[model samples]
Target chain A: MNCIPIMINGLPGNVARIMATSALRDERFSFVPFSLTGEEITQGEVSVDQTTVTLLKPSEREDKINDILGSYPGFICIDYTHPTAVNDNAKFYVAHKIPFVMGTTGGDRQDLERTVKNGSVPAVIAPNMAKQIVGLQAMLEYGANTFPGLFKGFSLQVTESHQQGKADTSGTAKALVACFNQLGTDFEISNIEKIRDPEIQKENLGVPEEYISGHGWHTYTLKAPDGSALFELKHNINGRQIYVSGTFDAVIFLKSKIDTNDFEQKLFTMIDVLTAGK
Target chain B: MNCIPIMINGLPGNVARIMATSALRDERFSFVPFSLTGEEITQGEVSVDQTTVTLLKPSEREDKINDILGSYPGFICIDYTHPTAVNDNAKFYVAHKIPFVMGTTGGDRQDLERTVKNGSVPAVIAPNMAKQIVGLQAMLEYGANTFPGLFKGFSLQVTESHQQGKADTSGTAKALVACFNQLGTDFEISNIEKIRDPEIQKENLGVPEEYISGHGWHTYTLKAPDGSALFELKHNINGRQIYVSGTFDAVIFLKSKIDTNDFEQKLFTMIDVLTAGK
Candidate 1:
């Protein structure tokens, strides 16, 4: 089951490492590495991730991409590099007429999409790559839209537990909070509980990072006055593969839509495609 | 700290055994077997909970109580028996001026209280005996009371995982769910998810039973239409000692609240007793 040939554009970074390692395991996808020239590969000495390669710094990115140009004539460039370089990479992929999967989480997505469109090369991009989590997210989206009357009279508590190394509140968690706020309850993103300790968890009061790291375990509890009833929803994630699998599917689907040549679009956001499909 | 002597009326139940063992290890309390009847000495069969020396027949209760009456004078009775006999034993304690802790769940409460009042006895009773968990419950109670706003749209799913052989839906889980309803939501208790199989959990979700047992793990999640925001609350328990400690405190506290001279004139539940001097 050799995968569709693809060239990974970022191998030295955290999410790229996850993507590269996961790509190696995906039978449906095979790839080459194209290290950016000017980026710093801080994963020093030995990267515990299974991806077999050294990071090529940013100064070498152009030569590396150019160096591999002759070997693979029609390769999909999977750009998981820093967001600062998304626009440049988008232009590069279009100039080479390469379909690409962009998973780098934070970037000026609008600029990338606009550049990809003007250049007319196929691309797929999204924030999270986990499929089941996306399914859960998708389900949440539908639930919120359909059940406008669901959370009436209930006070809400949103809690997200993540690995200790995670520095910020989870973007996914923040997004979910926004969804609930729209359900008519007045809530700020600051209201969410971001717990990162295992010790406090032992107290049975803290949400631990081990419980949230490499996976997302999000729970919401709704309480109402008068103590008459209750509602609770929880999602437990076991690994990061849930995201990887979903992202792969989205990328493949996006490629199919682009390759059909029915529309002259170079790039696509999952939201835009999901919205257009609706 | 030297503690007061107490007679455990339900000599052999799970709760009784745990209490006895914990008491034996601590210097604050001393315990002895006073509830075992003559018939138990003759029959030599231990109760199912392995704490009771014998299951005294209903007709034999009075003689059994009288048999150890003198030596156990001034001692407190810890009742962890069936609720049907609450009135009977409570009356015996009141008549004997015994201060006892009733940890048994459910029985004819009206008659039991009436007898306790008529006899001027003191007792500590609660459906749940865990302090930390109770505190969580208390906080939820406060939240539900303080903020009675309904959420515009929300969904609830409760999954309680327990060790095998726990045949009952967790009373605490149900109580929390009820609290959630008051905080504002609609849900049916019967619809709550109950996962019991360790093999299934390991296979389907890769979670070990050791991660969840001897207590409860509950999760409630609320989401809005756009899947942008979520709210959650969860509780996980590891052992039974939590309940034991609170029950112990409740017992010691109840002992001081009931004035032997005025026991017949007062009726109180654990809330009234546990909240004493708070």
Candidate 2:
């Protein structure tokens, strides 16, 4: 099997660094020795093991990308950039006919989908990369489709706890809320209880002290009107390993689709990856 | 309407006291002016506003119950006693033909149900009396009956935080686990994470200072096999108000059932009360 050459964006970000480390360890993938860094990053390069990856800021990417692509033709791009940069980065990839995997969330999601659909390049875009979580989501979607209004009269309460630096409610929690809504709940995305205080994470949420800076715990509760019955669901993630594994799987899946010339399915999601085997 | 006389047992216990206070404030029922106390109680009575309820120890209850029953014919009994006293207390109520509410959990639940089913007198039995939670359980039962194995490939993690004085896993959490099992997750009762240490409860579980002595926070998490999807449900109760209100509702429901000569349905649960109107 030929090694898949890939460029990992969002270097210096923790998630991006983790993904890059994982890809380096995998025998199937080879890094292109280039990364797209935030404009604020003063460092020209980032070190990974013994190899140093050259970092390109937005101002320098336009001039540098042509040379990088010329050196590693048909190479795939992996994005782990900020939510604000999702759309602009996708437009850049599409403008260059460079197929990519968008591992970042936020930015106008609808526009992200439209960019991939209308453009020549196909991409794998998902808010979440964990296969187990995506499989659960597929099941939820199944429930929503097969049993809509199943929890119509049930009252839902969503609570999520992450590292203190996370400024917003978990996008995964918000997506699950949408599934709940389709299953007959009237919950608003904004109603999610975001627990970002380290004290609360330790004292109230029962998060381990070591994982205080890198974990995600979410819970959704449904109660009856009379307060007699309750149905609860929850997920606790201790680290970024799950995301790393799933990101690799997405890369492999997207590569297979590209190899098969399946450009018609230009826009794909984690759900597609989850159900691909089935 | 005739005021139904009720004798709330377990005097000095916080839960029973809260129920007594609620009952005293409601005009629909009248107190029997008596309570059954544990043998350890040194006090002869407990005060509630202007009314003083005479406390009867285990030694006194056998003799006192006869006289009290003769005084207030067909009076209802509300038991909020120790787990050890559950079966014996039920035996006492059953032998005397005095219908009762078994609010306390633990101690051979199947035997308790059998006792109610075989006895001539009727009773309301439930592990949890919180109306909203009971209603949610009803919905869970509906889903379980309607969609068994709904979460087959899902992995479940149950975590519950309670007061340090609580020696066992929450009965409510255990009950919800049964629901999840029926819905397709293979989780054992012993697998539930019971949070008891005050430091852990305060630091990791986020129980409030005021409620550390009397709170129950339960979280149930389900994740797909590949870690791609997750669904969570949670319930955080600060105090016993929910249980108190639901206890009162159960009493009212039981009284109505007796009034209509519904002796055939002697074994009623919180679900019966929640769905009674529908």
Q: Please state the error at residue A87 of candidate 1 in Å.
A: 2.7
Model 2: per-residue Cα lDDT over A1-278, one tens digit each: 78898889999888899888988988999888999887899999999877799999889999999999999998899999998889989999999988898889889999998999999878889888876566555556655654566556779998999888889778878878998897788999989999989999999877889889998888888775655445676777877878887777778878888899877979988766655543
**Model number 1 iRMSD:** 15.5
TM-score of 1: 0.47
lDDT of 1 by residue, A56-97 (tens): 665655566665767666567677787677777777777766
In candidate 1, clashing pairs total 69
**Global CA lDDT of candidate 1, please?**
0.60
Cα deviation in Å at residue B168, candidate 2?
Answer: 2.0
Q: Which 10-residue span in candidate 2 chain B carries the lowest summed lDDT?
A: B138-147
Q: Which candidate leads in DockQ?
A: 2
Window of ten residues with lowest summed lDDT in model 2 chain A: A142-151
Write model 1 residue lDDT over B19-116, tens digit each, in one string: 76666665766565555222333554454333444445445766766656675555677777665666677776777677777777776877776776
Q: List runs of model 2 lying over 4 Å from the truth.
A: A1-278, B70-73, B107-111, B141-149, B178-190
